[model samples]
Target: MEKSVFEYSHYRSYLRMRLESAGRRGSKAQIATEMGVQATYVSQVLQENAHLSLEQAEAANVFLNHTSQESHFFLLLVQKDRAGTKSLRDYFQTQLDEILKTRMVLTERLGKSTQLDEKDRSWYYSSWIPSAIHIATTIPTLRTVGDLAKAMQLSSEKVMETLERLENIGLVRKEGLQFLPGEQQIRIGKDSHYILKHHTNWRLQAMQSLEHENLKELHYSAVVSLSAKDVDKIKDLLLESLKANVEIIKDSKEEELYCLTMDFFSLLKAQK
Candidate 1:
C-alpha cells in the first residue's frame, strides 16, 4: 500500500513510494518530467545522493497528486531532508509535527479515510467529551452546537472546541451551521495504548449512568472459576454473541447512539 506522505520524514522515501506504488501507473520518466530532471537523475535522487529543490519538490507534490495539506507536508519533508544540521532538521520536524497534529489527509483512492497521527489520536482519546460530540452528530435532532450542548449536558463553548478538534481529525463535519458525522471511523485495537483510556472513559460514564433509574441501562460483571476446557468454550460463546450483536447493530436505525463495551478475561494468574 502507498503510505501517507506524513508517514515519511524524507521526501525521497515518499517519492520512492510514489514510484512503485501499486495500481498507480507512474514511471521514472513521468516523475522525471514532473521534477524537471532526467530519468537517470530521478534514480540518483531516490538513491539519496541527489535531492529535490524547493520548486521541484512542489512539482513532485503535483505529480504525486497531493492534497494542499499533503503538499505542505511534502515540502516540509524536503526541507527537513535538506537541513544541514540536526537543529535545522529538528526545526522542520516541529513544522511537520504541527501539520500532522491538525491535518487528516484523505486518501480517497486508497479508501482509508482516517489515519490518526499520535498527537491527534491523543487529543481524540483524551476524554469522552470529544467522542460524545462525535456520536451526537449522528442524531438528527442534535445538529447545532446549541442542540448538542443541550442534549449532551455540555457548554456551547466546550462543544465548539471539541467539535473543532474532531473536525480537524476528520471525526466530524459541519455544513452551514449543522454538524454531521465525518466519513472517518476510529478503530482502537487491543494493543493500543489508548485502549485502556478508551475503555476507562466509557466505563466511568457507565458507572455514573447507574444513578439513572432506567430499565434500559444495563451492567454486568462476574468472575467465575470454571473447568479449564470450559474456559475457552465460554470465551467462544461471548465472542459469538458480540459478532451476532454487531450484525444486528449494523442494520439498526440511527435513532440513538450508544457504546457497548464487553470485557472477559482471566482474573487469576496462570497455573504455570
Candidate 2:
C-alpha cells in the first residue's frame, strides 16, 4: 500500500507512487501539464531522481492536492535533493526535522503524569518486559495477548501476567479483548533512580538478539586508544547523530518494534 505523502522523505518515490495509483495510470502527463513541462521531462526526471525546481515542485504540490503540512514537507524534500553542498543539505535537513517535530507534538506529547512514583518505577523498570509490553500495546497488531506473545516470542500465559501487571499500574487498558495505551503516560529520564535497571534490561535484550541470525540487525564493537581530544569529538558526533534520529522516532508512525543500543566508553581506569 502507498504511504501518505508525509511518510515519504524521497520526492521521486512519492511521485511515482501517486502516478501509478489505481485509475491514475499515465498521470505523469497530467502532472507535467500542471507544472507547464513536457510529459517526457517528468518521466525522465522521476526515473533518474533528477532535481525539480522549487517552482515546479510547488506546482506539483498543487497538482497532488497536498495538505499545507504535506506541501511544506514536499518542498523540503526537493530543497534537500537539489542541495549541492553538504552544508546546504544539512540546513534543509534541520528544517525537515522541525516540520516533523511540529506535526508530532500534538499527538505524541506525554501528559504531566509522566514521572512515575518510586514503587511504580521499580516495578515498571524492573525488567524490560513491563515497559516493552506497555509500548507494544500501541502497535495495532499487538493488542491481543496471543498477538503480542507471538510477536515478542513469549508464551501466552507470560504475556497475560505481564499485561495484567501493567494494567494495575495504568500502563495498559483493555477493551473488549483489545489492549490500548493507558491514559497515564510514562517517561523515564537519565536522572531517574531506576534508569540503570531500565538500561540494563534493554542491554540484556540486545545481547540475546546477537544469538539470532538477523542479517538486518546491527552490532559493532571496537577497542582503541585515541587522543583525549578525539574522544570528546567522537562522543559529540554520536550524540548529534542520536539527536537527529530521535526526531525521526518522535514523528514516525509505529509499525514495528525495534531497539537501538549504542555504547562507547574508556577502557582505561580513570585517574582521580
Candidate 3:
C-alpha cells in the first residue's frame, strides 16, 4: 500500500489548485527547475501521473509556500493514493473533519497498509456519534423526532435520548414544547479546530464524500403568527433562496410549517 510518486503528484496538484483559490501563487515549472527535473515531469505530477520525493517536496515548499504540516499532508495523500487501496478523496469525504485533521499525526502507524490496534479501534468508536442530528437546529421537536425515527425505522425514545444528551451539553434548546437549537449548530468536537485550520483541503474531501447526501422533510402543526396574506410571498422568497444553491438537491413541502434535515457526519474527521 505504499504510495507511488504519481499519486503524490495528484496531491500536490490538488494543493496547488487550493492555494490558488486562497490567493497564494506558485509555479510548478519553477519548482521542477529547482529540483532539476523537466517541466514535463512536473506536468505529470500535476496530472497525477507521477509522484513526489521528499527532496522534491522541499523544493515545492520554496515555490508553493506551504507550511511544514501542509507539505506532510500533501505527501500523505499521495502515498495513500499510490497504495491503490481506499481512495484518499473518498476517505476524506467519508471521514469527519476532526478525524481527518488528527489522523495525520498517526500516519506512520495508521496509514493505508496499517491495521488498527485495539486501542485505536476503541478510540475510533468512542469518537463516533451514534446518530447525527440533521435538523437545522440541534434540538429536535417532538414531531420531528417522531417522523425521523419512523423514517430511520428506530424507536422514538432512541431519538429522544440522543437529543436529550445534546440538550444537556447546551447544544440544544426547548421553547415551549418544541426543541430547537439555541443558535446555529456546526458539528465540532474537541479536535475540530484542526479542521478550521486546514479548511480548504478538507472541504474538497467533504464535497467528494457527500455522495449519499439526502434531506428529510419535516412539518410542524403549529400556526404561525404571521399574516396569511404574507405567506405566499414568504414561500416565494424561500423557493428563490433554495434555488440559489445548485447543491440543494431535494426539498419537500407538507401541509404545515416545515423544515428539511438529514443525519450526517458533522466532523468525523475530528470526532475525537
Candidate 4:
C-alpha cells in the first residue's frame, strides 16, 4: 500500500511519503525536531514550495536509516530537484537510470574511470592549436602548414609540429600537402585536470585582450552579493546560455572559430 522510495522522482515527494507513513505513530513536530527543522518548514517542503539544503538532506537520510543504495538514490533525487536547470536535472536523472540499470554502487562506478584518455584529453584542453586545426579543415584555403600558421598567427615550424601531433592523435589526417580533420568529437569530463588548465589558458587570453584596442572584442564583469540558492540558479542559467551558443555555432553554415568563456566566483568569503 506504500510507495517505495525508488518510485518517487522528486526528493520532496519521497520525504512527504516517508513522513506520511511514519505519521501514524509519530507527530510532525517530533519528526521536525529529529530533522533539526521547524514543523512549518517540513510542511512547506512537502508542499513543494521549499527545498532542503544538502546538510538537511543528509540528515534526513541518516534519520531515516536508509540503506546505502536508497541513501544514494535519495541524495541524487535531492540534487536533481534542486538543480537550477533542466539540462542538469536531466543529466542527473540519466545517471540515476544508469545506476538502476547496472545495479552497481554509484560511487564505485563513478570512481572507475574518466570519459577521456590522456592524449586526446591533453589535445582537447590545449590552447588554440586544436581549434585552429579543426577550423582550418572547414576552410579549403587553409589546408597547408604555412596557411594554418598564417591563419593562427603561429610560426610555420610550430604549426607543423602541432599538425604532426594532431595527426598522431588521429584527430587530423594528412592528405598529401593538406591536413583534414578526422571523424572525432571532442568531449571532456567536468572533473578533468585538463579542464582547469584549459580555463586558465583562455582566462589569460581574455585578460590580455584588455591591453589590446580590438573593437571586435568584448569583456564584462560584475560584483554583486547574492544568496547561495540564487548563485546556484545563476550557474544553471549560464550553462544553458553556453549550450545555446554551442547550438548556434553548430547550425551556422560558415563559422569563424572563437572562444567564449563565462566565469562566476565569489570574491569574498562568508564571515562566520
Q: List the candidates' TM-scores in order.
A: 0.57, 0.57, 0.27, 0.51
Better of 1 and 3 by lDDT: 1
Instruction: Name the candidate that leads on lDDT.
Output: 2
Give model 3's TM-score versus the native structure: 0.27
Cα lDDT of model 3 by residue, 72-161, tens digit: 555555555555555665664343334454644544333333233433333223422322342434333323555656654667666666
- Give the Cα lDDT of each candidate: 0.79, 0.79, 0.47, 0.72
Candidate 1 local lDDT, 1-272, one digit each (tens): 34677678788887887786665565788978977789888889989998888988888766665545667888889999899999999999999988876553443421464567788889889989888888879888887878988888888778877886776677876553466788877878989999999999988988888787377768887777899899899889999999999999888877776778888777776853
TM-score of 4: 0.51
The local distance difference test score of model 3 is 0.47
Reference-based lDDT, residue 162, model 3:
56
From the highest TM-score down, the ranking of the candidates is 1, 2, 4, 3
lDDT of 2 by residue, 6-95 (tens): 677778888888887688877898889999999989988789646789999999977775545567899998988888899999999899
**Ranking 2 against 3 by TM-score, winner:** 2
